[model samples]
Target: MNKLLKYLLATILAVSFINCTDNFEDINTDPNGISNQSLTQMNNHIGGSFTPMFLNVFNVTPAWNYQLQQGLLGDVYSGYMTPPTPFAGNVNNMTYALVDGWNGFPWSDAYGSVMPFVLDIKNAVELGNDPSGDKFVYLANIIKVSAMHRVSDIYGPIRYTKFDDFTTTGEYDSQETAYNAFFNDLGAAIDGLKSFESDSQFVPFDMSSLGGDIAMWRKYANSLRLRLAMRVVNVNPTLAKTQGEKSLSSDAGLLETQDMYINTGFAHPITVISGSWGDVRMGAEMESILEGFGDGREEKYFNPASDPALNGVFKGIRMGIEIEAKGQYGNHSSIGSVIDGETMQWMTAAEVHFLMAEAALRGWSGAGNVKAHYEAGIRTSFSQHSVSGVDAYLLDNTSTPKDFVDAINPINNIAYPSDVKIAYNNTGTNEEQLEQIITQKWIAMFPDGQEAWSEFRRTGYPRIYPVMINNSGGTIDTNIQIRRINFVSNEINTNSTNVNTAISYLNGPDNGGTRLWWDIPGSNF
Candidate 1:
């Protein structure tokens, strides 16, 4: 493990230096540093590159990296969890202060840890001229899309499509352009891997739950295509239908009974962040929705609050509230055993079902019976957590999200902003049915707050609580809420020209107030 870590760090440093220069070809071809020959023994040149990409997707080690990567942004914004510790004297991401120092993790982590490895894999495969190596490139592409899409969602424009081109390394692609490129790459990967479906070349290199199954990797790619397809349905329904239908009809199939998780070989970061550091706790919105619906997954997701005043109840802190100290909310419910394992979750079968349910709602082809898919989603999630009462839970119609009550601060209390229920509303309006599907999807995708937050911003379902504090200096609205994070300081400092060009692609300013391409503000219908 120590040897592998040293190698990964050395490779990353080499790649980082090559990537920083104006001419990648000049630096890469110079061959002064770790060369392909050095890594060729035992296929380490190609196989080893997969490790960093898998690890960085959720970043397992040094827990604080994971905290900055997603915990502070997606976890809180998605209403999944809130930090008890008030960093920067309470003026931070939670309050929409737009922390440049903190918000750069998602970008830096992706580019530094994930992207370079992907490029290396592609180069190694091409230079080797082995047809068998194409499978490695395909697998790397799948992982690249999975990791880079999250980065694109965070910041509206990202350095993708032309990342390997030295002349345009710093140029940014608009969110729309990036999504199109993602679809193209996923399509190529899905098609390219079909002939190699039975191949086991990936077994020794596989770190995911799929266990080196190429067919399963194809299924994951198809499912991810479906996910990205649905993300743009509102803005580009025709294109959405085309790609969504392709995913539905693909022989590669979608993730039905299986989930995609990367075995990071380390403790889940949330455990350390919530349990050891006492920095994170369940979000108030989570408490409102889960408790209001009488959700059986509550115990599976969070532990009872440690605060003696709460008396073992599942309590959560409201985000963006005035917190002078951590003790006020430090005893709030911490993450439970769900994330106690070593793997970092990527996608679930339950989430795939919900995506199909949404596809059905959109009247896309190959999406049979909306209610069936919706119910299947709920059942799959219940089974995943080993929770019971799924039958009665499916019949729930009277329950709605409960209003939140701040245990320590009454001023932080707020009403949950929805009346949506658990039962599949077959006869309800399109918008109402979407709310039901997205709300359930949001619940089932526990702890994967990046996707949850993106869906929340895209659909406006499962109405999350707005921040009580507004610290964006009026850049971000307290009501409409934050849309996307601003471009990182690293980019502005190093690639100011491209960063300015990227800002023009945004719907508004470059701050958190700006909406991305797919975040259309209107009814679901």
Candidate 2:
């Protein structure tokens, strides 16, 4: 085992089996002193194996790891924040030039930290004597789907569906195949969990906001099923509708009043934005949209700029700018305390409402009409952030995205892309209704820019600004923006044949310009 796998095994032995369990620590003692026969009775490690899988997907501490895994990639591409640091002489990912070193973290973290642990849980459950272990198998599958979907979204294909087999573990699955596997995994997880709805074994190990309520986990699984279903709506409408309706009609419920968040022991990673690193500032789209609408959540989401020229105004950096130094845009508005809590938002009630709204627009059965779901989404978002004046905000239909004026660089200023309003546009066409649903969903799912970026690619709503710098050197079109990042060089170095096979699955060359399987290249309607 290499260092990462070694670290994982050590962590499982030290923390997962002992600290994460209810009373495994008190019972298991003197492993070295015990004879071989005594060790066979300790099946406690099986239950504890899930702790690392639950936590590593989001990654709690040593925040810089998360900076590489998500903050620098998804968050930036989602038009949430832009880095001021001119890393590698401004030819890094912020400028559309792929950073091989930086891009490896998201992949390595998933395969190394999440996948191996999930494999362990599955293997241990299969070997265990207790039939109740089936519940844990279901739970592990849910975690696997949650973690791996993000990985599959980032790269067009991934080493899923065959990860358990040594001979085929290195092979890749196309995005469509991966998504189908996800639906199947989540479907089986939900059905298996139903029999264990009253089982309390999960409560001791669950660190999410759901508190190990099996019914609520069922709900989250169903909601995630809905999310994945919508992801492929444009490419695979029949499958999308089939899976989506199953979720909507299920009595297991959805994440309506409650939000899904992970309770990591440390502070949220947004501290890396506002703190000494000063690496990230608000994105130009955020400044334009939030300031234009006079959205009250602006105060909740970001702090005013430190630049005296802007006079404490909310400013944001446009992505892919030619920066000589960090000081150029470092003083712009930093992300605020909204993400400083113990938990980070995964899925929210507001987002679910918006998903339903889109489903309604598509004429899906269980989702209500476009108007009600759209308005409910906004209201739920306002309530989630504890921002008031929603009634007035919702009534005002004239507000639209304002032009973004960069505080430091006037050359970077640009006009807003769309005039889509805040109020529900019932008279609008299906495309217009979709724009309304996805745009609000984007705002409500703040800070978790991975999902936001994915939805933006799918819908192209709330038009995002294109890159100011095209360091991709013709591999990526600056106007089209980056569609998906190329496979990290680490895979090429370690698993060259598999990586080559994966590239063959791409619609185009293995570059940022290539669209994934689900990202249809037309109007959403």
Candidate 3:
């Protein structure tokens, strides 16, 4: 962490020096620069730094950055959306070739845009010696956990817990250590925010849909705690149960009424990728479940195909297939108007209901009826999208996912793997109910592929199709699929010693096939 921080600071200084003339006074006196005194006038330094952390969590700029951050990896792997373009001549992330060049964006975006701003807020509060500023620190920590958890989930070990300590070398926390830190940080944030529930200081600088409401922020934090709690249930059930009960009983409560969306004043990246560039389209798994169930949300999520051969049906491309050109599947469904707005959704109330449903299935205290929660998840998702016919949709026990048929290439088609139905079966086994909870959660989450991909790897629910092509040179298994992405090249190149130590923390070799700490290989029970 120290080395990376020094390198970033040095680069900034180098760029500033390059633009300077011979006059030191002229170079030092930039009229447009905001002074430290001015920053302290209204805590601009603390509040302004939060915007980047919010935006970079999903990255709403340049569009391609978001494409690499999650669209290319989780969006495809979660069976949500797949790119029509066969980048690198068909040797790319979809086929398990694992492009090092594109895979570094998630890592770099966090360290560059998120971590630095967090450190700035902490430093500003501490340097001012203002105990009243603790509210700002608490808010910053909540945002930090929200951002860094995604980074850790993607690459397993990341530079967290000791990021501010410049004395230590660039050491990385193993995924387990990082998760424990995430839990502790979230717990502390939830507690510290209770007194500031009425504080209105955050409103002017609030960029999220919460609108600087401290009460809502605390609720979001509690909901996030439950999410992280459920993520570790498979590997450490006792700890998971403890944390899950804590979040459920907390007075802060979870996100129950509305979704958490970051108002990143840019067009949704899906619009650019699927609508403008034609690089992305619906996934085969999405087609199977949505179309087969006759779900009303399908019309809100995607448009019918434009190709005359398919006759304007909602179609998608199978991942890891042989495609010589994009034109073959370019006419497949594009993203619909649901995400045409300026905000990027982070977490939803529907997701929290599904989480509660899973917690109840695990028999955690304070987790109410499982069937009720499951049904509420479906209703909440339909309500969020303003879709009708959820009553009929939830009762349909007969419809299962349909087999996928690639209209462009017949060889890429595959059968739907699971027979899981739409209706919740109370008499079914625990595993069966768990699958029902997760599969509905998957559909309710819609375009958030990062969390969806993580859930799929953790629970093995909502059976997705395996890749038709394997280009990993045996580093990845076709059946096991890609478990985790390898560490990026930037870390290996700049921080070789620490990156090597981080690789040893993984369960297997640091490749796409290696499982993270929470991705256990056995039954859900």
Candidate 4:
């Protein structure tokens, strides 16, 4: 009986071992590489990819890179267009449609990517998954404010408050309402971040090389707060001052470390659509500004004058802004009329410092020196960014308009004589302040030049040169220039009511000529 029992036990053990081997945790219920969940993983991908296309940093899906196209025309900045020649058609071609197209540019953006970044921040905070949740909240507010700033500037008022509800039913919010919400969101973010003290204990998924850090996020948030305050130009000066104070105070936020900047790498350009210069050229206004500052970034930004295109017939008609004018060096298609998206340039350190200086000048209670911030802004532009050859530029200090004239023959060697006035006045008037801020901001934002046009529209400084060809309808008021962009066909068909409601707030029809409700002079005075 004992021998029989032992043999039975052994058999049972053998059976159990066989069963364990058969069940070896190889559950095919789910698979690797491909997963049911994609939106979460791809949200940052979309944000990082699409956001820079408008700014000319990198190119993704090339079908709808029109934001950069219209952005240049609206601001009168040169962009990536072929042949590098000026336009002859009416303004309706570029102004009404091209500029207006940017108004609804965000339409084609993948909801899966943009929505999750904003939503997950709120979700993770509520779920209590990480200590940096408040930082996420801060980022959420920054993202909303920055996105809205762009959308409103381009299209006019947009869906706010209920913006996150687009998954169910998105509602368009008024400019006033949007501004109020923008202010509230930033205010709350500021408060939350101030009280946030705990470091996220979990190992961060190695964004170190990418320059993602908490302190940097806070700094970028504060800089955004300052930018938003400037938008309340026509609403209430007292409120603007109050917000400005909040942005500049010791309690004011900033992306302190260099690690916080959005770094550009050779590994991948966030928004390069085409790899050749056939798509872009240097704008005259940008050339004027950089030459004025004796900026050293001209070599990388500009093409040489001896190219076959710019010499014989086309002298003043190069595309791309903040870079020098040049004809194609070697049939470079990427250097066309639009900003090159394949090029890798992101937010600059000079931008952060410039924002800090602007905040300090606004009388915020921070430890930074306002003047030093301005100087640092210039220094970084020469030192860190890809623009090479500075010593020669500074020796010239200011270049006159005639200095840019290219020779008329082939082998057209373009040696520009110095002729620009660099001493910008700080104490002239409110308009003066706005120009100084925007001009520096413009200098800081190269490669990604969409913001330059946006800033030009927002404040109307650097009175731009009208197209040599009178293509635009007389609607772009000589004084005010292009005001708002027309609503796109996509929005009219999909969100008609909201689009109409938003349109009504615009002083004119939703076309490019209308001044947004916030742009008119209530507090802009």
Cα lDDT for residue 389, model 1?
Answer: 100
- lDDT by residue (158-245, candidate 2, tens digit) is 9999999999999999888999999999999888889889988777567689998999999999999999999999998999999999
Please give, for residues 1-525, the per-residue lDDT of candidate 3 as tens digits: 553343344335333423432443454445687445554666665676777777789988889999999999999999999888989898899999999999999999998888877776787688779887888888988988998899999999998987889964379999999999999999998999899998898886677889999999999999999999999999999989999999999999999888999877678988998888999999999999999899899999999998888888999888999978888789999888788888899999999999999999989999999999999999999999999999998899999999999896788989998889999999999999999999999999989999999999999978878998899999888998899989999889989999999999999899999999999998988
Each model's total of backbone clashes: 0, 0, 1, 53
Candidate 1 residue pairs in clash (backbone atoms < 3 Å): none
- Looking at model 3, residue 476 earns an lDDT score of 87
Give, for candidate 1, the lowest lDDT window spanning 10 residues: 17-26
lDDT of each: 0.90, 0.83, 0.88, 0.48
CA RMSD, predictions in order: 3.5, 4.3, 5.1, 11.9
Candidates arranged by TM-score, highest first: 1, 3, 2, 4
Tell me the spans in candidate 1 whose CA falls farther than 4 Å from its real position.
1-41
Please give the range of 10 consecutive residues that has the lowest summed lDDT in model 2: 35-44
Candidate 3: regions farther than 4 A off: 1-38
lDDT of 4 by residue, 1-525 (tens): 553343344334323323433342442125664231342243221122223222222222342344343324433442212224222232233333243444344544423334344554465455545455456556555655655555666666766677556573456777777777887887776666655434341112212222334444556566666666766644565776677667767364554334223222222221232233233334555555555565555554544443565442222333211212233222332322223322333355677676666655656556377656766676677665555554454344344333334233323223333232334345555545545655666766665554566555555544454333323456655334556666667778888887887777767776556777556532224
Task: Name the candidate that leads on lDDT.
Answer: 1
The TM-score obtained by model 2 is 0.93
After TM-score superposition, what is the CA distance of residue 356 in candidate 2 from its true location, in Å? 0.5
Q: List where candidate 2 sits over 4 angstroms from the true fold.
A: 1-11, 14-43
C-alpha lDDT (0 to 100) for residue 181 of candidate 3: 94
Name the lDDT of candidate 1.
0.90
